[model samples]
Target: MQNDLVSIITPSYNSEKFIAKTIESIINQTCENWEMIIVDDCSPDNSNEIIENYMQKEKRIKLIKLKKNSGPAIARNMAIEQAKGRFIAFLDADDIWLPEKLEKQLLFMKENDLSFTYSAYRLIDEEDNDLGVFIPPVLADYSSLLKTNFIGCLTAIYDTNKIGKMYMPNILKRQDYGLWLKILKQIKSTKGITEPLAIYRIRKNSVSSNKLKAAMYQWKIYREVEKLNIFQSMYYFMNYAYYGLKKY
Candidate 1:
C-alpha cells in the first residue's frame, strides 16, 4: 500500500450485490495514489466473502470486519480511524465513482487549497441503472451548508492536513450530514466540483425515502445537537422540502 495515499473509506453492510462494482470503481480510478479501506459493519449477507475474494487479488484493498452491527456512523468512524492518507475520501459500498473522480477532485482541492470538498452526483437505481443526473445547486460556504446537506458522501473528499478526523454520531441515519456539520465547524469553507463524478444508488426501500423520518433526524441534529433556533429549523425544513420534491 502507498504511504500518505488518498484513503477511500467505504462502510458496508449487506452490500454483496454491489460491493464488487464499488471496488472496481476504485480500481479503475485514473489517479492511482489511493488505498480503499472497506469496513464491514457485521453484514449478515455474503459481503465479507465478496470483499475477501477481491482483497486476495488486490493488495491495495483492505477489509476490516466489525464484531457487531453498528450503524453507518460507527462503521465509517472505524474506517477513518484506520485510514493513513493525506486526503480522506468516502464512498458508500453501493455508490460508485467515475473514472476521473479522484483526478479531478484532487486537482481542484490542491489548486484551491480547500480543506473539504464535494462533487455533483448522478442518481442511480438499485440495479445500477442511471436516472437523470443531479447537479449541486451551488458550491457551499459555511452559511449555505447550514441550510441543507447538499453534499453527497460519495462525492466528498477532505484534506487530512487541515481536518485530520471525521467524527460521526452513532445515530440511525443522517450520520453523513452530521459529520459534514462537524467538519464545517472546524473549517469555514467547503468547495464543490460542479461536474458529476459519482453515482448515488437510491435503494428501493431505503430510509432516505422516508421524508418524515429523515426530517426527524435532521431536526435532532440541528436542534438538540447543533442548537439551531426554530427559524433556522424552518429554513432547513423548507430546504429539505425543496430537495425532496425535486428529487422525487
Candidate 2:
C-alpha cells in the first residue's frame, strides 16, 4: 500500500516540556518513509513555536493549528484527515519512541500480513524514569477488548489499505479505546508485539491517572458508545475492573 509509508498522528496542547524530545525521537527513527502530522489545539504555550521551528528544517513534519482549543479527539482527527500514508500510527506529544520502533513495527505487520498491530511499551515518569513495561494481550478481538483496552494508542498502527481510514469517536476520554473497538469490529483481531518499542510518559496529577474517572469513562464507552445492555455492561465492567488492577 503506499510502499510502507507511515503517518504519525500527534495531538498536542501545552506540551512544551516534552514535545521537543518526542519530535527528536521520531527524527531518529530507523524508518525513513514516514510523515508526522502534528495538530495543535490552541496551545497557550510555546508548543507552536517549537513545532514551527521543526517545520522549517524538516519537510516531513506538518503542523496544523486549530482556530480554537479542542480535545485530543478532534486534534487527532484533524491530523488523520491530513495523513497521506497507508499506515496510520499515533504518538502523543509527550511520549518518546525508540529509534527502531517504526522500522520494527512495520516489518512485523508486513511480514505477518496483519492489518492492525500494537506493541508493548515501558512507562516513564515526569522525570523520564523507567516505571516498568506493560504487556498487552498477544491477540485481541472485539469481544476481549470490550473487557479492557490493551492497545496503547502510542504503540498502535493500522493499515489504511486494509481497513480504510478510521477515526476516533468525539469523546473527551477513551477515544483511543473507541477507535480500537471500531477497528476490531471490522477485523477479527490485532496482533501484539511484546517488545517495548515506545516510552509512555506518566505525568503526576494527569486526568487519565485517576482510576475512578477512567473506570467511569470506560463504563460510558460500554453503555453509550457500544450500546450494550445492563447485564452485558456489568459483565464487561467486572472484567475491566479486574484487568485494570492487573494492568497498571
Candidate 3:
C-alpha cells in the first residue's frame, strides 16, 4: 500500500446531475495525495461521460465500469480490492467535502495515532439548500454502534496499516453500517470531530428515507449479518428505532 495516500471509493448510478460537482469537490481539496476511484454501476445516464471528461484532465480520477448493475456494496468492494493507498475513505456521487476536510482529518488521525475516524456533516436538499448540521458522538465502539450507525460513510476514514483491510458484507442495504461495525470489532473505538466536514444531500426518494424499510434492513443486519440472537437483535433494534427516528 502507498503510505500516506488516501484512496477514495465512490459509486455512481444515474448520478449525472451531481457527479461533476462531486469530482470538482475532490479536485479543490487542500490535500493533493489522493486518487478517486469511481465505479459506474451500469449507469444508463451521462454519469460516465462526465467522469470521462474529468479524467482527460485529472489523472488521479479513475473509473471502473461494471458489466452488470451491481449494488453499491459490490462497487465499493471492487474499489477496495484495487486500492493502492494505506488510507481509505468513501464518498458518494452526490456528497461534497469541505476544502480542509482531508488536510485537517489526516492531521487529526496522525497526531493522535488513530486508526478509524469520522466527522460531523451538514445536510443539503436536492437543490443545495442547507437543511441543518449533524454532530455524531465524539467516540464510539462496537457495542455503541450496534444501537445505531453514527458514521457517515462520506466522512469516514480507516488506516490499513493498523487493522489490515476490512470489507463490507454483500448486502443490498446498510452495507456502510456493516463495514463500520466490522472495523469497530477490531479497534477499541472510532473517533470523530464535532466540526462539520462534509455535505450530505438528502433526496426525497432515497431508500434510507423509507423509515419502515430501513428498520427492516437494520434488523436483518443485526440478526443475519452479525449473527445476533433474537433477544439481542430485539434489544439493539429498539435502540436503533429510537435514535433512527431522531435522525434528519
Candidate 4:
C-alpha cells in the first residue's frame, strides 16, 4: 500500500469549532499520500473560511462549497464523485484520527488483501474529552451488519479499485450504514482492526444524540431501502437495540 493515494471525504456543516483539529489530525498522520476533500454543505458559520485557511497551507486538502444546503450524504457523494484514489476513507469534520491510523490500516488491508475494513474508536464529547468508552471491533459480514452497524464512519476505509466507487443512500441519518451494507454485499466480509484509531465526537443536540429519530431512520433503511420483510426487520432491530445498549 506504499505510495497509494487515499481519498479522505469530510462533510462539513457549521463545524467551525472543531474542523481545525480534524485537519490537524490528518496532517499529523504518518501516511503522507492522501487527498482530503472537505465538502462544505452551505455552512452558515465560518466553516468555509477555516477550511480555506487549511487549504491554503496544504495543497493536498481541497474544498468543495455547495451552493445549497444539502445533507451529509449529498456532500459526501460530491467528494466520492471527484475521488481519484485507490482507497476511499470517511472522516467527518468533527472527528479525529491518530497519527498511525492511515498507515496501519493500509498495511492491514494490504496484508489481508481485504476490500473493506474498519477499526475501533473512542467516543468523545464536544470538548474532545474522552468519555472512557471505546467501541470494540467486530468482523462483520452483510448479515451481521444488518443486525447492527459496528463500523464507525470515522474509522472505515474501503478499496474503490475492488468494489468501485459506492455512494451513500440519500438519507438524513444512517447513510454510512447504507454504504457499508452496499460494499459488504459485494465483498466477503469487512475485517476489523481491534485498536482504537479514531475519535468520534458526540455533540449534544446533534442528530446522533436523538435516539428516537435514529431508530426511525434505521426502520426506514430496513423497510424502504433494504426492503426487508417485517419479521426480518424486527429481528435485526432487536439485535441493533441490544448491541447499542451494550456499547454504552
Candidate 2 residue runs with Cα over 4 Å from true position: none
Q: In model 1, which range of ten residues has the least summed lDDT? A: 137-146
Q: State the lDDT at 55 in candidate 2.
A: 88
Estimate the TM-score for candidate 3: 0.98
C-alpha-based local distance difference test score of model 2: 0.93
Ranking by lDDT: 2, 3, 4, 1
Tens digit of per-residue lDDT, candidate 2, span 9-29: 999999999999999999999
* Cα lDDT for residue 124, candidate 1: 84
lDDT of 4 by residue, 109-206 (tens): 99998988999888899977778646555678989998878888999999887888899999888899999998888885768898999999999987
Report the C-alpha displacement of residue 74, candidate 3, in angstroms.
Answer: 0.4
Q: What is the lDDT of residue 240 in candidate 4?
A: 85
TM-score of every model?
A: 0.94, 0.98, 0.98, 0.96
Per-residue lDDT over 89-134 for candidate 3, one digit per residue giving the tens place of the 0 to 100 score: 9999999999999999999999989999999999999999999998
Q: Which stretches of candidate 1 lie over 4 Å from their true place?
A: 1-4
Instruction: Give the clashing residue pairs of candidate 1, or none.
Output: none
Error of 2 at 186 (Å): 0.7
lDDT of 1 by residue, 1-248 (tens): 35447999999999999999999999999999998999988889999999999999999899998898888888888888998898889999999999999999988988998988899999889876778887775567656666767899999888787777767777788888877888877886667877899999988777676677777887888787677899988887788778777767
| lDDT scores in order | 0.85, 0.93, 0.92, 0.90
Model 4 pairs in collision: none
Q: Tell me the TM-score of model 1.
A: 0.94
Worst 10 residues of 2 by lDDT: 202-211
Looking at model 1, residue 129 earns an lDDT score of 78
Per-residue error (Å), model 2, residue 205: 2.5
